[model samples]
Target: MNAIAAPAAADDNGLETGLNATLREPISADGTPVLGKTYTVPARHGRAVRVKAGQTIRIANPHGTQVCDTWIFNAEHLNEFLSFEHTRAYIDRIIPQPGDPLVTNHRRPIAELVADTSPGVHDTLMAACDLYRYRNLGVEGYHDNCADNLRLALKAIGLRTREVPQPFNLWMNIPVKPDYSVEWLPPVSKAGDYVDIKAAIDCVVVMSACPQDIIPINALNPLDVEFTVLDPAVSSHS
Candidate 1:
Protein backbone atom coordinates (compact mmCIF):
# COMPACT_ATOMS: atom_id res chain seq x y z
CA MET A 1 0.00 0.00 0.00
CA ASN A 2 1.21 3.53 -0.71
CA ALA A 3 2.13 5.37 2.47
CA ILE A 4 -0.06 8.31 3.37
CA ALA A 5 1.09 11.50 5.05
CA ALA A 6 -0.58 14.49 6.65
CA PRO A 7 -1.26 17.50 4.37
CA ALA A 8 1.20 20.34 4.80
CA ALA A 9 0.50 24.01 5.34
CA ALA A 10 0.90 26.49 2.52
CA ASP A 11 3.53 29.17 2.39
CA ASP A 12 3.21 32.76 1.09
CA ASN A 13 2.98 31.41 -2.46
CA GLY A 14 -0.25 29.57 -1.68
CA LEU A 15 1.77 26.45 -2.33
CA GLU A 16 1.10 24.44 0.86
CA THR A 17 -1.71 25.30 3.21
CA GLY A 18 -4.99 24.36 4.78
CA LEU A 19 -8.02 26.23 3.34
CA ASN A 20 -6.77 29.49 1.93
CA ALA A 21 -9.08 32.24 3.04
CA THR A 22 -8.40 34.41 0.01
CA LEU A 23 -9.11 31.65 -2.49
CA ARG A 24 -12.59 30.80 -1.25
CA GLU A 25 -15.55 31.67 -3.57
CA PRO A 26 -19.25 31.78 -2.79
CA ILE A 27 -21.79 30.03 -5.06
CA SER A 28 -25.30 31.38 -5.17
CA ALA A 29 -28.59 29.68 -6.05
CA ASP A 30 -29.26 32.10 -8.88
CA GLY A 31 -26.32 32.01 -11.28
CA THR A 32 -26.63 35.70 -12.21
CA PRO A 33 -26.42 36.89 -8.59
CA VAL A 34 -22.75 35.92 -8.47
CA LEU A 35 -20.55 38.98 -8.94
CA GLY A 36 -16.75 39.32 -9.25
CA LYS A 37 -16.15 37.13 -6.23
CA THR A 38 -17.67 34.03 -7.81
CA TYR A 39 -16.19 31.66 -10.30
CA THR A 40 -19.04 30.48 -12.45
CA VAL A 41 -18.49 26.79 -13.20
CA PRO A 42 -21.16 25.89 -15.69
CA ALA A 43 -22.59 22.38 -15.37
CA ARG A 44 -20.29 20.08 -17.30
CA HIS A 45 -19.44 16.53 -16.38
CA GLY A 46 -16.12 14.72 -17.08
CA ARG A 47 -13.92 17.68 -16.12
CA ALA A 48 -10.22 16.88 -15.69
CA VAL A 49 -7.24 18.52 -13.96
CA ARG A 50 -3.45 18.03 -13.96
CA VAL A 51 -1.91 18.96 -10.60
CA LYS A 52 1.80 18.56 -10.19
CA ALA A 53 3.02 15.95 -7.70
CA GLY A 54 2.92 16.99 -4.02
CA GLN A 55 -0.05 19.30 -4.44
CA THR A 56 -3.39 18.70 -2.75
CA ILE A 57 -6.70 20.17 -3.93
CA ARG A 58 -9.77 20.63 -1.73
CA ILE A 59 -13.25 20.80 -3.26
CA ALA A 60 -15.57 22.58 -0.83
CA ASN A 61 -19.25 21.88 -1.11
CA PRO A 62 -20.45 25.11 0.44
CA HIS A 63 -24.01 24.19 -0.35
CA GLY A 64 -25.21 20.81 0.89
CA THR A 65 -26.58 19.10 -2.23
CA GLN A 66 -24.27 20.11 -5.08
CA VAL A 67 -22.76 17.31 -7.17
CA CYS A 68 -19.21 17.77 -8.49
CA ASP A 69 -17.94 15.29 -11.07
CA THR A 70 -14.13 15.05 -10.90
CA TRP A 71 -11.20 13.39 -12.66
CA ILE A 72 -7.39 13.66 -12.60
CA PHE A 73 -4.71 13.23 -15.26
CA ASN A 74 -0.97 13.02 -14.90
CA ALA A 75 0.72 16.26 -15.97
CA GLU A 76 3.32 14.21 -17.77
CA HIS A 77 1.12 11.62 -19.43
CA LEU A 78 -2.62 11.97 -19.92
CA ASN A 79 -3.05 8.46 -21.31
CA GLU A 80 -2.45 6.83 -17.92
CA PHE A 81 -5.29 8.56 -16.11
CA LEU A 82 -8.11 7.62 -13.75
CA SER A 83 -10.24 4.76 -15.04
CA PHE A 84 -13.78 4.55 -13.64
CA GLU A 85 -14.06 0.88 -14.59
CA HIS A 86 -10.89 0.08 -12.67
CA THR A 87 -12.08 2.09 -9.70
CA ARG A 88 -15.40 0.23 -9.60
CA ALA A 89 -13.63 -3.10 -9.92
CA TYR A 90 -11.32 -2.16 -7.07
CA ILE A 91 -14.23 -1.18 -4.86
CA ASP A 92 -16.03 -4.45 -5.71
CA ARG A 93 -12.92 -6.49 -4.92
CA ILE A 94 -12.52 -4.88 -1.53
CA ILE A 95 -14.81 -5.41 1.46
CA PRO A 96 -16.48 -2.01 1.06
CA GLN A 97 -14.32 -0.49 3.74
CA PRO A 98 -14.91 3.20 4.39
CA GLY A 99 -11.36 4.53 4.00
CA ASP A 100 -9.85 2.24 1.42
CA PRO A 101 -7.68 3.80 -1.34
CA LEU A 102 -9.15 3.85 -4.87
CA VAL A 103 -6.38 2.68 -7.16
CA THR A 104 -6.22 3.26 -10.92
CA ASN A 105 -5.84 0.76 -13.75
CA HIS A 106 -2.11 1.48 -13.87
CA ARG A 107 -1.95 0.20 -10.28
CA ARG A 108 -1.28 3.71 -9.07
CA PRO A 109 -3.13 5.18 -6.11
CA ILE A 110 -5.67 7.68 -7.47
CA ALA A 111 -7.50 9.27 -4.54
CA GLU A 112 -8.24 8.31 -0.95
CA LEU A 113 -11.64 8.44 0.70
CA VAL A 114 -10.45 10.79 3.43
CA ALA A 115 -14.00 11.51 4.50
CA ASP A 116 -17.50 10.24 3.67
CA THR A 117 -19.75 12.55 5.68
CA SER A 118 -22.76 11.57 3.61
CA PRO A 119 -24.78 8.36 4.00
CA GLY A 120 -25.15 7.66 0.27
CA VAL A 121 -22.28 6.35 -1.84
CA HIS A 122 -21.28 8.26 -5.01
CA ASP A 123 -22.01 6.67 -8.39
CA THR A 124 -19.26 5.18 -10.53
CA LEU A 125 -21.64 3.98 -13.25
CA MET A 126 -23.67 7.14 -13.70
CA ALA A 127 -22.41 9.07 -16.70
CA ALA A 128 -21.83 12.79 -16.40
CA CYS A 129 -25.06 14.78 -16.97
CA ASP A 130 -25.21 15.97 -20.56
CA LEU A 131 -27.57 17.74 -22.94
CA TYR A 132 -28.78 14.48 -24.42
CA ARG A 133 -29.48 12.99 -21.01
CA TYR A 134 -31.31 16.11 -19.91
CA ARG A 135 -33.55 15.98 -22.98
CA ASN A 136 -34.19 12.29 -22.53
CA LEU A 137 -34.88 12.65 -18.79
CA GLY A 138 -37.59 15.28 -19.43
CA VAL A 139 -35.42 18.16 -18.22
CA GLU A 140 -34.36 19.40 -21.62
CA GLY A 141 -34.26 23.10 -20.82
CA TYR A 142 -31.36 22.65 -18.40
CA HIS A 143 -29.09 21.18 -21.03
CA ASP A 144 -25.79 22.72 -19.90
CA ASN A 145 -24.28 21.81 -16.54
CA CYS A 146 -21.30 19.87 -15.19
CA ALA A 147 -20.53 18.65 -18.71
CA ASP A 148 -20.01 22.26 -19.76
CA ASN A 149 -17.84 22.78 -16.73
CA LEU A 150 -15.59 19.97 -17.95
CA ARG A 151 -15.35 21.54 -21.36
CA LEU A 152 -14.34 24.87 -19.87
CA ALA A 153 -11.70 23.26 -17.68
CA LEU A 154 -10.29 21.40 -20.65
CA LYS A 155 -10.25 24.55 -22.74
CA ALA A 156 -8.43 26.41 -19.98
CA ILE A 157 -5.75 23.70 -19.97
CA GLY A 158 -5.42 23.77 -23.80
CA LEU A 159 -6.64 20.17 -24.14
CA ARG A 160 -8.96 19.27 -26.96
CA THR A 161 -12.60 18.53 -26.20
CA ARG A 162 -12.33 14.86 -27.12
CA GLU A 163 -9.81 14.05 -24.37
CA VAL A 164 -12.28 14.45 -21.51
CA PRO A 165 -13.61 11.15 -20.12
CA GLN A 166 -16.15 9.87 -17.61
CA PRO A 167 -15.55 11.40 -14.16
CA PHE A 168 -16.22 10.46 -10.54
CA ASN A 169 -19.34 12.14 -9.18
CA LEU A 170 -18.31 13.81 -5.93
CA TRP A 171 -21.47 14.78 -4.07
CA MET A 172 -24.10 13.05 -6.20
CA ASN A 173 -26.04 10.42 -4.24
CA ILE A 174 -26.30 7.12 -6.09
CA PRO A 175 -27.58 4.36 -3.87
CA VAL A 176 -26.82 0.73 -4.65
CA LYS A 177 -29.03 -2.03 -3.33
CA PRO A 178 -28.27 -5.62 -2.31
CA ASP A 179 -30.10 -6.77 -5.45
CA TYR A 180 -27.56 -4.88 -7.63
CA SER A 181 -29.97 -2.14 -8.61
CA VAL A 182 -29.26 1.60 -8.29
CA GLU A 183 -31.32 4.68 -7.54
CA TRP A 184 -30.54 8.39 -7.73
CA LEU A 185 -31.48 10.39 -4.68
CA PRO A 186 -30.73 13.63 -2.92
CA PRO A 187 -27.09 14.40 -2.23
CA VAL A 188 -25.70 13.81 1.27
CA SER A 189 -22.91 16.40 1.49
CA LYS A 190 -23.33 19.18 4.03
CA ALA A 191 -21.92 22.68 3.94
CA GLY A 192 -18.16 22.65 4.71
CA ASP A 193 -17.72 18.88 4.44
CA TYR A 194 -15.52 18.09 1.42
CA VAL A 195 -13.99 15.10 -0.32
CA ASP A 196 -10.26 15.71 0.21
CA ILE A 197 -7.58 13.79 -1.64
CA LYS A 198 -3.82 14.01 -2.15
CA ALA A 199 -2.70 13.41 -5.70
CA ALA A 200 -0.59 10.28 -6.12
CA ILE A 201 1.08 11.77 -9.21
CA ASP A 202 1.40 15.24 -10.68
CA CYS A 203 -2.19 15.66 -11.82
CA VAL A 204 -4.79 18.30 -12.37
CA VAL A 205 -8.08 18.04 -10.48
CA VAL A 206 -11.12 19.06 -12.53
CA MET A 207 -14.52 19.54 -10.94
CA SER A 208 -17.98 20.92 -11.74
CA ALA A 209 -20.08 22.24 -8.89
CA CYS A 210 -23.27 20.82 -10.39
CA PRO A 211 -26.14 23.14 -11.32
CA GLN A 212 -29.09 20.84 -11.81
CA ASP A 213 -32.36 21.96 -10.21
CA ILE A 214 -34.66 19.44 -11.88
CA ILE A 215 -33.05 16.74 -9.76
CA PRO A 216 -32.64 16.59 -6.01
CA ILE A 217 -28.86 16.17 -6.28
CA ASN A 218 -28.74 19.89 -5.72
CA ALA A 219 -31.76 19.83 -3.42
CA LEU A 220 -34.01 21.36 -6.13
CA ASN A 221 -31.92 24.51 -5.65
CA PRO A 222 -28.38 24.29 -6.91
CA LEU A 223 -25.80 26.16 -4.90
CA ASP A 224 -22.15 26.99 -5.32
CA VAL A 225 -18.95 25.17 -4.16
CA GLU A 226 -15.36 26.26 -3.49
CA PHE A 227 -12.06 24.74 -4.64
CA THR A 228 -8.71 25.26 -2.88
CA VAL A 229 -5.23 23.87 -3.37
CA LEU A 230 -3.11 22.58 -0.46
CA ASP A 231 0.56 21.79 -0.49
CA PRO A 232 1.91 18.34 0.25
CA ALA A 233 4.94 17.78 2.47
CA VAL A 234 6.28 14.72 0.68
CA SER A 235 7.18 14.46 -2.99
CA SER A 236 5.06 12.31 -5.29
CA HIS A 237 7.88 9.80 -5.52
CA SER A 238 8.22 9.50 -1.77
Candidate 2:
Protein backbone atom coordinates (compact mmCIF):
# COMPACT_ATOMS: atom_id res chain seq x y z
CA MET A 1 0.00 0.00 0.00
CA ASN A 2 1.16 3.57 -0.77
CA ALA A 3 1.75 5.80 2.20
CA ILE A 4 -0.38 8.94 2.41
CA ALA A 5 1.23 12.31 2.80
CA ALA A 6 0.36 14.50 5.82
CA PRO A 7 -1.60 17.67 5.31
CA ALA A 8 0.58 20.64 4.39
CA ALA A 9 1.04 22.88 7.37
CA ALA A 10 2.27 25.90 5.44
CA ASP A 11 0.74 27.89 2.59
CA ASP A 12 2.33 29.81 -0.26
CA ASN A 13 3.37 32.53 2.16
CA GLY A 14 4.34 29.97 4.77
CA LEU A 15 1.49 31.13 6.99
CA GLU A 16 -0.46 28.57 8.98
CA THR A 17 -3.04 26.83 6.78
CA GLY A 18 -6.06 28.10 8.64
CA LEU A 19 -7.55 31.60 8.51
CA ASN A 20 -8.57 31.60 12.17
CA ALA A 21 -5.08 30.65 13.24
CA THR A 22 -2.25 33.09 13.84
CA LEU A 23 -1.92 35.68 11.06
CA ARG A 24 1.20 36.07 8.93
CA GLU A 25 1.03 39.70 7.78
CA PRO A 26 3.30 41.98 9.78
CA ILE A 27 2.61 45.67 10.35
CA SER A 28 5.26 48.22 9.48
CA ALA A 29 4.87 51.96 9.34
CA ASP A 30 1.39 51.39 10.75
CA GLY A 31 0.50 49.35 7.64
CA THR A 32 0.80 52.51 5.50
CA PRO A 33 -2.91 52.18 4.67
CA VAL A 34 -4.19 53.25 1.28
CA LEU A 35 -4.72 57.00 1.20
CA GLY A 36 -7.89 57.23 -0.84
CA LYS A 37 -9.47 54.66 1.43
CA THR A 38 -8.54 56.71 4.45
CA TYR A 39 -11.40 58.55 6.17
CA THR A 40 -11.01 61.85 7.89
CA VAL A 41 -12.88 62.58 11.10
CA PRO A 42 -13.07 66.34 10.96
CA ALA A 43 -12.57 68.32 14.10
CA ARG A 44 -15.60 68.13 16.36
CA HIS A 45 -17.05 65.42 14.12
CA GLY A 46 -17.28 61.64 14.33
CA ARG A 47 -17.14 58.62 12.03
CA ALA A 48 -18.11 54.95 12.14
CA VAL A 49 -16.24 51.93 10.77
CA ARG A 50 -16.56 48.18 10.47
CA VAL A 51 -13.41 46.27 11.24
CA LYS A 52 -13.06 42.51 11.08
CA ALA A 53 -11.25 40.28 13.47
CA GLY A 54 -7.46 40.26 12.89
CA GLN A 55 -7.72 43.61 11.11
CA THR A 56 -6.41 46.80 12.65
CA ILE A 57 -7.74 50.31 13.02
CA ARG A 58 -5.14 53.03 13.12
CA ILE A 59 -6.06 56.46 14.43
CA ALA A 60 -3.49 59.11 13.55
CA ASN A 61 -3.12 62.62 14.80
CA PRO A 62 -1.16 64.06 11.92
CA HIS A 63 -1.47 67.60 13.18
CA GLY A 64 -1.02 66.31 16.74
CA THR A 65 -2.40 67.03 20.19
CA GLN A 66 -5.96 66.15 19.30
CA VAL A 67 -8.12 63.76 21.29
CA CYS A 68 -10.11 61.05 19.57
CA ASP A 69 -12.75 59.63 21.85
CA THR A 70 -13.27 56.01 20.81
CA TRP A 71 -15.97 53.38 21.35
CA ILE A 72 -16.46 49.85 20.07
CA PHE A 73 -19.46 47.56 19.66
CA ASN A 74 -19.79 43.89 18.88
CA ALA A 75 -21.02 43.49 15.34
CA GLU A 76 -22.91 40.27 15.96
CA HIS A 77 -24.67 41.56 19.08
CA LEU A 78 -25.75 45.17 19.25
CA ASN A 79 -26.60 44.95 22.92
CA GLU A 80 -23.05 44.00 23.81
CA PHE A 81 -20.57 46.86 23.58
CA LEU A 82 -17.27 48.05 24.94
CA SER A 83 -17.67 49.01 28.55
CA PHE A 84 -15.40 51.25 30.60
CA GLU A 85 -16.38 49.54 33.80
CA HIS A 86 -15.56 46.12 32.42
CA THR A 87 -12.28 47.28 30.94
CA ARG A 88 -11.24 48.89 34.21
CA ALA A 89 -12.18 45.81 36.16
CA TYR A 90 -10.40 43.44 33.82
CA ILE A 91 -7.31 45.51 33.20
CA ASP A 92 -7.31 46.72 36.79
CA ARG A 93 -6.29 50.10 35.52
CA ILE A 94 -8.14 53.07 34.11
CA ILE A 95 -5.82 53.03 31.09
CA PRO A 96 -4.52 50.02 29.20
CA GLN A 97 -1.11 49.41 27.70
CA PRO A 98 -0.08 47.87 24.43
CA GLY A 99 -1.15 44.20 24.18
CA ASP A 100 -4.07 44.76 26.54
CA PRO A 101 -7.41 43.65 25.18
CA LEU A 102 -10.38 46.00 25.31
CA VAL A 103 -13.40 44.08 26.54
CA THR A 104 -17.13 44.49 26.00
CA ASN A 105 -19.98 44.81 28.46
CA HIS A 106 -20.43 41.07 28.24
CA ARG A 107 -16.73 40.63 29.09
CA ARG A 108 -15.76 39.47 25.65
CA PRO A 109 -12.55 40.66 24.04
CA ILE A 110 -13.23 42.93 21.11
CA ALA A 111 -9.95 44.68 20.42
CA GLU A 112 -6.36 44.92 21.57
CA LEU A 113 -3.88 47.77 21.68
CA VAL A 114 -1.18 46.57 19.31
CA ALA A 115 0.98 49.57 18.56
CA ASP A 116 1.63 53.03 19.91
CA THR A 117 3.97 55.79 18.83
CA SER A 118 2.88 58.40 21.31
CA PRO A 119 3.48 58.53 25.05
CA GLY A 120 0.41 56.32 25.44
CA VAL A 121 -1.43 59.06 27.25
CA HIS A 122 -5.17 58.42 27.38
CA ASP A 123 -8.20 58.63 29.67
CA THR A 124 -11.09 56.36 30.69
CA LEU A 125 -12.36 58.33 33.64
CA MET A 126 -14.42 61.23 32.36
CA ALA A 127 -17.42 60.51 30.19
CA ALA A 128 -17.72 61.90 26.68
CA CYS A 129 -18.72 65.57 26.67
CA ASP A 130 -22.42 66.09 26.05
CA LEU A 131 -24.77 69.05 25.56
CA TYR A 132 -25.81 69.05 29.18
CA ARG A 133 -22.20 69.20 30.38
CA TYR A 134 -21.42 72.06 28.02
CA ARG A 135 -24.44 74.04 29.11
CA ASN A 136 -23.32 73.75 32.71
CA LEU A 137 -19.91 74.96 31.63
CA GLY A 138 -21.50 78.24 30.59
CA VAL A 139 -21.56 77.48 26.89
CA GLU A 140 -24.50 79.00 25.03
CA GLY A 141 -26.24 78.07 21.83
CA TYR A 142 -25.77 74.78 20.02
CA HIS A 143 -22.22 73.45 19.84
CA ASP A 144 -20.43 70.29 18.83
CA ASN A 145 -19.51 67.78 21.50
CA CYS A 146 -18.35 64.20 21.82
CA ALA A 147 -21.75 62.96 22.97
CA ASP A 148 -23.45 64.32 19.86
CA ASN A 149 -20.64 63.15 17.66
CA LEU A 150 -21.02 59.63 19.03
CA ARG A 151 -24.72 59.70 18.16
CA LEU A 152 -23.93 60.79 14.63
CA ALA A 153 -21.29 58.12 14.32
CA LEU A 154 -23.76 55.50 15.46
CA LYS A 155 -26.36 56.75 12.98
CA ALA A 156 -23.88 56.39 10.15
CA ILE A 157 -23.56 52.72 11.10
CA GLY A 158 -27.30 52.18 11.51
CA LEU A 159 -27.13 52.45 15.28
CA ARG A 160 -28.62 54.95 17.70
CA THR A 161 -27.32 57.27 20.41
CA ARG A 162 -28.71 54.89 23.00
CA GLU A 163 -26.15 52.36 21.83
CA VAL A 164 -23.27 54.68 22.56
CA PRO A 165 -21.24 53.57 25.55
CA GLN A 166 -18.15 54.71 27.39
CA PRO A 167 -15.34 55.50 24.99
CA PHE A 168 -11.60 55.02 25.37
CA ASN A 169 -10.22 58.53 25.11
CA LEU A 170 -7.29 58.13 22.74
CA TRP A 171 -4.44 60.57 23.22
CA MET A 172 -6.26 62.36 26.03
CA ASN A 173 -4.19 63.48 28.98
CA ILE A 174 -6.00 63.36 32.27
CA PRO A 175 -3.49 63.16 35.08
CA VAL A 176 -4.56 61.23 38.12
CA LYS A 177 -3.60 63.30 41.13
CA PRO A 178 -2.01 61.94 44.29
CA ASP A 179 -5.35 62.33 45.98
CA TYR A 180 -6.97 60.07 43.36
CA SER A 181 -8.40 63.07 41.53
CA VAL A 182 -7.62 63.54 37.88
CA GLU A 183 -7.00 66.82 36.11
CA TRP A 184 -7.56 67.51 32.44
CA LEU A 185 -4.41 68.44 30.59
CA PRO A 186 -3.02 68.70 27.09
CA PRO A 187 -1.97 65.53 25.34
CA VAL A 188 1.68 64.59 25.36
CA SER A 189 1.52 63.15 21.86
CA LYS A 190 3.22 65.11 19.10
CA ALA A 191 2.59 65.36 15.37
CA GLY A 192 2.40 62.03 13.51
CA ASP A 193 1.69 60.15 16.72
CA TYR A 194 -0.78 57.30 16.43
CA VAL A 195 -2.13 54.12 17.96
CA ASP A 196 -3.17 50.89 16.28
CA ILE A 197 -5.41 48.13 17.52
CA LYS A 198 -6.24 44.65 16.27
CA ALA A 199 -9.86 43.67 16.42
CA ALA A 200 -10.42 40.44 18.30
CA ILE A 201 -13.94 40.27 16.94
CA ASP A 202 -15.95 41.90 14.20
CA CYS A 203 -16.69 45.31 15.66
CA VAL A 204 -18.09 48.70 14.88
CA VAL A 205 -15.47 51.33 15.62
CA VAL A 206 -16.67 54.80 16.59
CA MET A 207 -14.67 57.93 17.09
CA SER A 208 -15.25 61.56 17.93
CA ALA A 209 -12.47 64.04 17.37
CA CYS A 210 -13.22 65.59 20.71
CA PRO A 211 -14.65 69.12 20.36
CA GLN A 212 -13.74 69.99 23.87
CA ASP A 213 -12.00 73.36 24.13
CA ILE A 214 -13.03 74.19 27.67
CA ILE A 215 -9.84 72.56 28.89
CA PRO A 216 -6.41 71.70 27.49
CA ILE A 217 -7.33 68.08 26.73
CA ASN A 218 -6.80 69.01 23.10
CA ALA A 219 -4.41 71.89 23.56
CA LEU A 220 -7.50 74.08 23.14
CA ASN A 221 -7.36 73.34 19.41
CA PRO A 222 -9.54 70.83 17.68
CA LEU A 223 -7.93 69.24 14.61
CA ASP A 224 -8.84 66.69 12.02
CA VAL A 225 -8.05 63.02 12.69
CA GLU A 226 -7.26 60.22 10.27
CA PHE A 227 -8.88 56.80 10.54
CA THR A 228 -7.68 53.82 8.59
CA VAL A 229 -8.67 50.17 8.70
CA LEU A 230 -6.18 47.66 7.40
CA ASP A 231 -6.46 43.94 6.82
CA PRO A 232 -3.13 42.34 7.46
CA ALA A 233 -4.37 39.08 6.01
CA VAL A 234 -4.67 40.66 2.57
CA SER A 235 -1.71 39.82 0.39
CA SER A 236 -2.13 43.00 -1.66
CA HIS A 237 -1.42 45.07 1.43
CA SER A 238 1.94 43.35 1.71
Best by lDDT: 2
Model 2, which residues run further than 4 Å from truth? 1-36, 233-238
| lDDT per model vs. reference | 0.55, 0.73
| Window of ten residues with lowest summed lDDT in model 1 | 13-22
Model 1 quality (TM-score): 0.69
For the record, the alpha-carbon RMSD of candidate 1 to the native fold, in angstroms, is 13.1
lDDT measured at residue 45 in model 2 versus the true structure, 0 to 100: 76
- Candidate number with greatest TM-score: 2
Q: Tens-digit lDDT track for model 2 on 53-136?
A: 877888899888899999887777767878889989998888888889899888878899888889888888788886667778
Q: Could you tell me the lDDT of residue 72 within candidate 2? A: 84
